[model samples]
Target: MITFYDILGIALAMSIDAFCVCICVGMKYNKPANYMRLGAAFGFFQFIMPVAGAYAGRLLMKYTGNIKYLAAAFLFYVAFHMFREAWKNKECKVYLSDPTVGVALLMLSLATSMDALGAGISLALWDGGIIWASCVIGIVCALMSFLGVFIGKRSRGYVGHYAEYFGAFILAVIGVRFVL
Candidate 1:
């Protein structure tokens, strides 16, 4: 049986990616409405993708194992991208009024949260349902993303870059850990 602590751990770990991505999107976008939509999209996908992974794991193991590698690769890739973006010398104004940004945000959110999907596979293998886990992860990610966006919008200075770098480093370490 999954305890509340388990849920909290899973939620916090899963939400780290969302938190980092949300901050970047918030910095890149302007409309508050867009942030709301982005948050909802991230939360929804984070919730659903894990459940899907869990079900898929029940059907087979080879695919599930591949998912772990895929997720690790994605995390490292995104981490490096964030690092590069943050390190860039040019500063450009955000054109957030465009809805196309939402697609990009969605893709970023999905990429960063892929590890949680594989974790869900482990849960399914253990015969543990993801309902509780998903609820915790979804809610935590929504809130963390909201906070991250709000902070990014307000700070827009040294702190945001630091956070991005830190997230990227963490993702790199996690990816290496997964590979080894």
Candidate 2:
């Protein structure tokens, strides 16, 4: 069903934002538990945003069907940009070298998951079960984000560039598939 695919796609798309940010944050922290906390925070936000969006989306029925396409377009655009950056033979750089904890993490989580909020609106329009979709999104984001942080901490040298390119590629592919 469209709902299922939308839920899956939204989960993947939204998770990437948190994943990318979390990876950068991982570079700042030495303790492993910090990574877990970031992931959990991201997961929680990713989960909540959609449910809220879905509720709001239901109130605006006219725009529901179009959300997927919009999300896909946005994702593809991001992916292409990342891919271009990666393809360029430039030195890898860290954007947020000093990630904050607690309040900072909360801010980052909410900010990054904005897309998920939009997707949640779409999911609500599709009559997707909020509980199930939120849980899935939460779990998917938690796992991917945790992995991203782990990998970033471990491979501090060359992984950042690759992660961007890979994430971008994934977004583009998902977008193209949705458009098709």
Candidate 3:
């Protein structure tokens, strides 16, 4: 069974991408509505993707043995992706006056929530309460994106950049927990 802290950690880990991307959006578009829309879009994606992945994971779970190992692999991949991005340390810029609409929004949301889907696969294999887990993840992501925008506008992307590493660390630890 997964603990509350585990869900929270996953949520935080899953959110860092959206948070980092929104920081870039915030740097350019300084509107409150943009922040909400970005957060909502990302949060909605983050909410739904994991649910979808968990159901998909359910199908895969039946054929698998020691599913925790598979779960850890997924989580570890997500963690590695984040860590790799952090190491690259490149500032991703959204060249738009309002990035909360149209293709940009959809692509960004999907990109960030990919990790959540992977996490859902891992969690679903172990726990039956994925809806709750996904919900917490969405809420935390929305809140983080909201704050990330504000921080970005104020700090010029300095503070927001390092968060990915911390989030990656959390995910890596959780992934380790799954196997051991």
Candidate 4:
């Protein structure tokens, strides 16, 4: 059984990408209403993706016969990708004068929540409660994203990238924990 702390940790780890991207969104738009919109979009996707992934994972597990290692592998891949993106793009700039909405916002939400899909697969392998876990993930991500915008507005871009690195490290650690 997955403890609350474990679920919390996973939710936080999954929220990092959304938080970082929301920081960029906040920096770009710098409007309070935009923060809410972006947060909702991110939270919604973050919620839905895991449920979909968990269902898919259930199907895959039947064929694969035990997917804990596969889950760890996916986490590792996500971690490595996070590191690579952080290193490759030392700084990100968004030049739109207006807040992101519509298709662009949807794209952004989907991009950031991709890791949660992998996490959902792992959650299934571990026999965790998908509904509760996803709810927590969504709520936490929404709050983080809302805050990230404010933080980004006040600070420069350096912090957001480093946050991504930290997130990657957290995910790698979680993946290692699963393996052990």
Candidate 5:
């Protein structure tokens, strides 16, 4: 059974990507409405992907027999990639001149929510409530994304980058916890 703490941790871990991208958007486009649009886009996708993944996971569960190990492995893989990205601190170009609500925002939202699909699969393996978990994930992501933009607008440099590292550590610990 997945506890509330576990769900919260996973949600936070998943939101890191959305948060980071929102920060970049915020830095480039400081419009208040743009922040809401970004948040809605990110949150909505984050909500949808997990539910889809959970359904897929349920379909596979009968054949797999045990999904805990798979979930742990997937979490570890996500954590590893997150850590790698944080270490590299790759430069991403955000077009300040471009419209905030269009293909670019849709693509960003889709990119960030991919991890939630994996997380949804993991949640299904753990017998988690996909709807509830997804709601929490969506709400948290929305709030984080909204806030990230403001933070980015106010600050410069790599101040918010540490969030990815922290999120990675949380995911890694959760993965190990599941294994043990």
Candidate 6:
């Protein structure tokens, strides 16, 4: 029987990606509202994905094993973009940096939540309810990502021009983790 502690631990573990990605976003922008928005996006994905995985785990896996690779590819692409932006002499572009908005937001949310999806597959076997666990995970992810953004924003000046580079490195590491 899974306990609340177990769920909390899982939530913390799963939120790392969102937190890291949010730190990246925070580096470029100091807006707290945007940080929450990014966190919400991640939280929403984290919430839905695990439920999807719990219900549709085996069914979906049969159709494709490339989900991990696809996620990794997206992360790597995003990371590469970040690295490029960091290297450029001009001001960083808005589209990629402001991941609180469109496709970039969705992709990052999906990529980061992949692990939560995997965790959900195991949740099917546990006596603990899926909804409650997913809720906790979502809330934790939102909070952590928000905190990451704040921290990143605070550290921006200290990091100087390399903030994007660090963020990109974090994303790349996350990508590599998804693959292996």
Instruction: Please provide TM-scores, in order, for all candidate models, with all chains considered together.
Output: 0.63, 0.73, 0.95, 0.94, 0.94, 0.65
lDDT of 1: 0.63
Cα lDDT tens digits, model 1, 75-156, are 5775677678657623423444543254776676677568667656544534355776776677877887787677657765
Which should have the higher lDDT, number 5 or number 6? 5
Give the TM-score comparing model 6 with the true structure, all chains together.
Answer: 0.65
Q: lDDT winner between 3 and 5, please give it.
A: 3
- Candidate 1's TM-score: 0.63
Q: Which one is best on TM-score?
A: 3
**Candidate number with greatest lDDT:** 3
- Which digits, one per residue and each the tens of the lDDT, describe model 2 over residues 5-71? 6567667766776776666666656367877787788899889988887777666656544566665
lDDT-best of 2 and 3: 3
Q: What is the per-residue lDDT of model 6 for residues 1-180, given as tens digits with 9 covering 90 to 100?
A: 446765665577567667766665787865867887888999998898778766664454457643556555655775676577557623322244567887878898998888677667645545567888899989999898888788667764333235556656766666666567
Error of 1 at 10 (Å): 1.4
Find the 10 residues in a row with the least total lDDT in model 3: 90-99
Best-first order by TM-score: 3, 5, 4, 2, 6, 1
Would you list the clashing residue pairs of candidate 6?
none
Alpha carbon lDDT of residue 79, candidate 3?
Answer: 88
Displacement of the residue 138 alpha carbon in candidate 5, Å? 0.5
Candidate number that wins on TM-score, 1 or 4: 4
Q: Give per-residue CA lDDT, model 4, range 21-63, as digits (tens).
A: 7777777686878888888998998898889888888999999
Question: What tens-digit string does per-residue lDDT give for candidate 5 at 1-180?
Answer: 679999999999999998888777777786878888988999999999889988888877878777888888888988988888888885545665644678988888899999899888888866556899999999999999998888778764255568889889988998898788
Worst 10 residues of 6 by lDDT: 89-98
Provide the global lDDT of candidate 5 against the true structure.
0.84
Off by over 4 Å in 5: 90-92
Q: Which stretches of candidate 3 lie over 4 Å from their true place?
A: 92-94
